[model samples]
Target: MQNFLNLCNAVIGEDYVLHEPAKQAPYLQDWRQRATGQCLAVLRPANTEQVAQLVKLCAEYQVPIVPQGGNTGLVLGSIPDQSGTAVVMSLQRLNKIREIDTANSTITVDAGCLLEAIQIAAEQADFLFPLSLASEGSCTIGGNLSTNAGGTAVLRYGNTRELCLGLEVVTADGDIWHGLRGLRKDNSGYDLRDLLIGAEGTLGIITGAVLKLYPKPISQGTAFIAINSIVQAVALLHLAKQQCHANLTGFELINQLSLELVHQHFPQYQRIFQQARRFYVLLELSTYDNEQVTKQLLEHLITTAIEHGLVEDAVVANSIAQAKNCWALRESISAAQAKEGKNIKHDISIPISQIPNFVQDTDAALQLAFPASRMVTFGHLGDGNLHYNVSPPCGTDQDSFLEHHAEINRIVHDKTDQFGGSISAEHGIGTLKKQELLRYKSPVEIKLMRAIKQALDPHNIMNPGKIL
Candidate 1:
């Protein structure tokens, strides 16, 4: 460990290597408050070359290397194991917006650049980099790309995997793969850029990427509506899609429990609707028309939905400020839940058609198994992903409730498997979902994943014990 630390310090200077326990403590834990681990040192590399060199040195010593970005991941992919044999490679220093080509509609950015920074940059250029999330302010593009993050915008723009054009990666063997072309169409032999996108840092370390950008919407509108059930929410989504078409940018589902959590934790947000239903849909409309057309269209859609019995009540944001406020409520769900108490989170996805049944069955099963638990469910219904979380009952001790995490996971994940859904959707199978992945995946699928890992990282040093 001492020798490795000395080598890292020599390569990147003493200021970049953190060995003290106090300074390393923050990097050892994940955002979920789970899986704290120990590492010899945290190394900060400034550029792709530095990253390549660090990987080479670690590979030479047969030491495990964990590539981390922003450290906002729900999974323990970035945290080292308790063995203290791994080195945490922090990519924060590599942040740099290389270029923004308005003509090609692409933005070249280093992996360490925060998602919000990219969004702001695109906005400044009068363009849109559509990959967004609640953690956009802190989560890095590298992490987003690594996890292939799905956000509210995925209904229209697609996930991180679809938004990326090219990549610059540091392979496990210390070689750099510079495929950062801003081309729209490339019929190449293999889409290597995608292979590393959601690999959870097991295949390689993403240094930078060329991301796709779209024309900024000239007009925007937002609507918050209360629905009777998940089935009604799905029905409304289908209706909205048919009516609004491309203007329907976002369609999210929020439950009453989640809304109450937000209202209780974030008092600044004014609850718009008087009555609370079982579920709510926060729908957004955007178009090229820079006049009142967008608002008129949104209002008409809401009115139609109400007449069809799809929506009980609705409120359309009157101004840009109101739209932002409405979004704040949706974005605050995760944080509000955190402030309320400890809970088990599952980011799962099912077929659009099966969502209603999946939610009903899972909620019923969890209720039967853990009678006192509260299910705070909400997510991008348009994309079939739901943040189905199980919180401890009111006035109950969080620690005691969390003790049944394993059993709770079995119940939730088993239900997901039964419905042909994924245990993990947007989040990758980092350490958190490794066992679930093994159990859910077919033997052939697991074999293919292992074969790829062995081929790319024969020593099993790059993010060891991850995905596979």
Candidate 2:
């Protein structure tokens, strides 16, 4: 152990190697406080070369490594194990925008670049990087790629995996695979770039990536609509798609409970409507065309939906500030839930058509089991992903409520299975959902995943005990 520490210190400078408990504690624990771990040391590597060397040394010494980004992951995937044999690798210093090819409509960036930073960079170049989330200011692109994160824009831009065209990775044996090509059409061998994007760093460490960009929208339309039920919301979604066509960029669903939580926590964010309905949708559309046409089209879509009884009432943002204010309501859900109490969150997805059935059945089953629980449902309705979360009764002990996590998960995940939905939609299978992945994935699928893991990280040193 002493020899291993000396090697790491020598390679990454003594200052970059952390040993004190207080200094390393932040890296070993997750942001949500649901997981805490112990590590022998936390190593900050500045670039891909340093990462390759550190991984090589760790591979030779048989020490495990956990690649962490901003430590903002909902799952405990980035946290180290309690054995203290693992080295936590932080990619914070590798923050750089390598290239921006406007002709190719792509930008190459380092793994540690913040998501919002990338968005700003693209905007500076007069392009758009549509991958966004509530944690855009904190979450790094490396974590986003590793988890294949999805946000409101996924309905139009797709997940991180679909946005990425190439990747640079450090294999478990210390080899750097430079696959960062900006080409859109490359019929190569097996798609290794796709493999590393959503593998949760269990297969290899992602160092950099080439991501797709789009033309900045010249006109934007945002609206908040009163929703009656999930079925009605889905119908409104279909109607909006037909009206807006490819210009529709976002379609989000929010429940009354979620909105109430936001109202309780963030009073300054005035409600979009005077009277809140049972559900709501924060929808958006954009186009490169003139603003007048976009505004007229938005108004027409809302009018048609309201006339059909699909929407009870609606409020369209008349100004940029109003649109931003409307967005704050959707972005504040997670923070509001945290302030409320202990929550059992399920980031699951199913066929877009079955969402209504899934929600009705799951809510009924959960209500029968725990009548006191509150279900806060909201997500990207266009892509069929819902962050269906349950908060314990107002006064239930946090620990006692957490004890029912497994049972609560069973009830929700079982319903998800009945609807043929995935257990994890965007959040990867970190320590939090390992067993769930096993139960949901088929034997052949699991075997194939294990085989790939063995082939890339034969020693099981890269993010050991994660994903597969």
Candidate 3:
């Protein structure tokens, strides 16, 4: 172990190799603080070349490697295990924007670049990178791609996988694959780029990527609507799509309890509606037309929905500041839930048509089993992903309530499977969801996944206990 450490220190400067407990503390835990791991060391490489060299040394010594980015993953994918046999390879120092090709409508960036930084760079170039997340200020692009993260803009821009054109990766055997080509069409053979993506760093370590960009919208509109039920919300979504067409970029569904939690924890964010309804939809539209045209279209859509009895009441943002404040309410749900207490979180997705029924059935089943358990349900309605979470009954002990984690997960995930929905929508299967993945996937599917893992990482050293 000492010999391996010496070699790592030699490849990257001694200062970059963090072996002290104090120095390695932050990288040893997950974003949610659900679990803390122990590592032999935390290695920070400045560039792709140094990463390759460190990986080669790790391969030579048979030491496991955990490729981490910002350490912001909810699952325990980016951290090492309690065995303390693995080393965390932090990509923090590899922060750079390699190039921006306006003609190709792509930006090549290092793995460690912050998501917000990339968005700002794209805006400066007079283009739009529409990958917006609540954690945009902290999370890195590498983590986003590795998890194939889905945010609000997924309805229009799609997930990180769809946004990426190519990737530069370091294989398990310590060989660099320079596959960063910003080509929209390449039908030569199997797509290695897509394989490495969303693999949770099990196949290879993503070092860099070429990401797609878009022209900025000429006009934007945001609205908050109060609805009677999930059924009505779904109907309103259909109506909005018909009226706004491709201009409808976002449609988020927020249950009453989620809004109450936000109000309770963050009183600064004023509510848009005076009276609360069972559910709320934070919808947005972006178009190439002017602001007046956008406003007129939104007013027309709202009027039509109200006439159809789909919307009880709605408030459209009259200014940019108002639109931002409307978004702030939607973005504050997760944090409010955290401030309330620890809870079981499920990032599931079902067919859009089945969502209303699925929620009704699941909510009833859960209430019957665990009475008074708060359901903080909300997510990207347009794309069919829901962050369906459960807080303990009022006055119940958070840790004690968590003792029913396995049972709660079973209730939710089984229904998800029954509805033909994915157990994990945006989040990848780290150690947290590995068993669930096994139970949900068929024998043939699991076998194929394992075969690919074996072929790409024969040594079982690239994030060994992740997705597969």
Candidate 4:
């Protein structure tokens, strides 16, 4: 370990290597605080060459290496293991915007750049990079690519995998793969960029990428609609899609429990509708026209939905300020839940057509199995993903409450599989869902994954024991 530290220092200087426990502590734990591990040191590589050198040295020594970005992952994918034999490589220093070609509608950025930063850069260039999330302020683009993160804008722009045009990666053997091209159509034999997009760093370390950009919407409109149930919410989604067509940028479902929690935690932003319903749909519309077309379209859609019995009541944002306020409510769900109590979160997804049935059946099953639990279900209804979470009953001990995590996961995941859905919709199967992946994935699928891992990282040096 001492020799390895000396080599790292000699290669990247002493300031870049953090050997002290205090300095390395934050990188060792994930965002969930569920897994804490020990590491020999945390290396801050400044560029792709430095990353390649570090990987080569680690591989030569047969030492495990964990590539981390932002350290905001819910799963322990970015966290090292208990062995204390791994080196946590932080890509935060490699952040740089290499290029923004408005003609080609592509933005090339370093992996360490924050997702929000990329969005802002695109906006400054009169374009839009629409991959957004609650963690955009902190989550790195590399992490988003590694997990293929899905966000509310997926209905319009698709997930991280679809947003990426190309990637520049450092292979396990210290060879750099520079495939960053901004072509709209590439008839290559195999799409290697897609392979590493959601590999969670098991295949290679993503150093940078060329991401797709879109035209900035000249007009935006938002609405908060109250509905009877998940069934009505799905119906409302179809109605909005039919009425608004491509302008329908987002359609999210929020349950009463989730809204009430937000209201209780954030009293300033109360319900926007005049009357409360069993569920709510937060819909957004965007267009290139700066006229009142957005507002008119929203009102028309809401009126149609009401007439069709899809929505009980609705409120459309009158101004930009109101639209931002409406978005705040949707964005505050995770924080509000954290303030309320310990939550068991599941990011699951199913076919859009079967979402109504899945939600109804899962809610019933969860209520029966955990009578003392309070469920707060919400997420991107347009994309068929939900952040199905459960809050412990009042006065339940935190440790005891969390002990039922396995049981809760089994119930939710089993039903998701039955519906041909994924146990992990957006969040990658880090250490948190690694065991679940083994359980839910078929033997053939697992074998293929293992074969890919062995092919890319024969020595198991790149993020060992993760996503395998």
Cα RMSDs, all models: 1.1, 0.9, 0.7, 1.1
Per residue, candidate 4 scores C-alpha lDDT tens digits across 1-468 of: 788789999889999899889999899988867779999889999999999999888988888889999999887899999999999999999899999998899999999999999999999999999998989999999999999999999998899999999999999998999989887789877899989999999999999999999999999999988888888887888888888888989998998888888888998885686566788889999898774888888888888888888888888888888888888899999989988988899999998888778878887888898776888889999999999998888887877878999998998899899899998888999878989999999999999989989988999999988987
| Model 1 C-alpha lDDT per residue in residues 141-196, reported as the tens digit of each score | 99999999999999999999999999999999999999999887899788898899
Kindly list the per-residue Cα lDDT of model 3 for residues 1-468, writing each as its tens digit: 999999998999899999899999999989998899998899999999999999899888899999999888887889999999999999988899999999999999999999999999999999999999999998899999999999999998899999999999999989999999999999989999988889999998999999999999999999999999999989999998888899999999999999999999999998798798999999999999999999999999999999999999999999989999999999999999999999999999999999998899999999999999999999999999999999999999999999999999999999999998999999888999999999999999999999999998889989878886
Model 3's C-alpha root-mean-square deviation from the true structure amounts to 0.7
Task: Sort every candidate by lDDT, greatest first.
Answer: 3, 2, 1, 4
Candidate 4's C-alpha runs over 4 A off are: none
Q: What TM-score, over all chains together, does every model reach?
A: 0.98, 0.99, 0.99, 0.98
Candidate 2 to truth, TM: 0.99
Candidate 2, residues 281-395: lDDT per residue as tens digits? 9999989888888899999999999888998999999999999988999999999999987899999998999999999998888889888888999998899999999998878
The TM-score of candidate 3 is 0.99
lDDT of 2 at 412: 93
Instruction: Judging by lDDT against the true structure, name the best candidate.
Output: 3
Q: Tell me how many clashing residue pairs each candidate has.
A: 0, 0, 0, 0
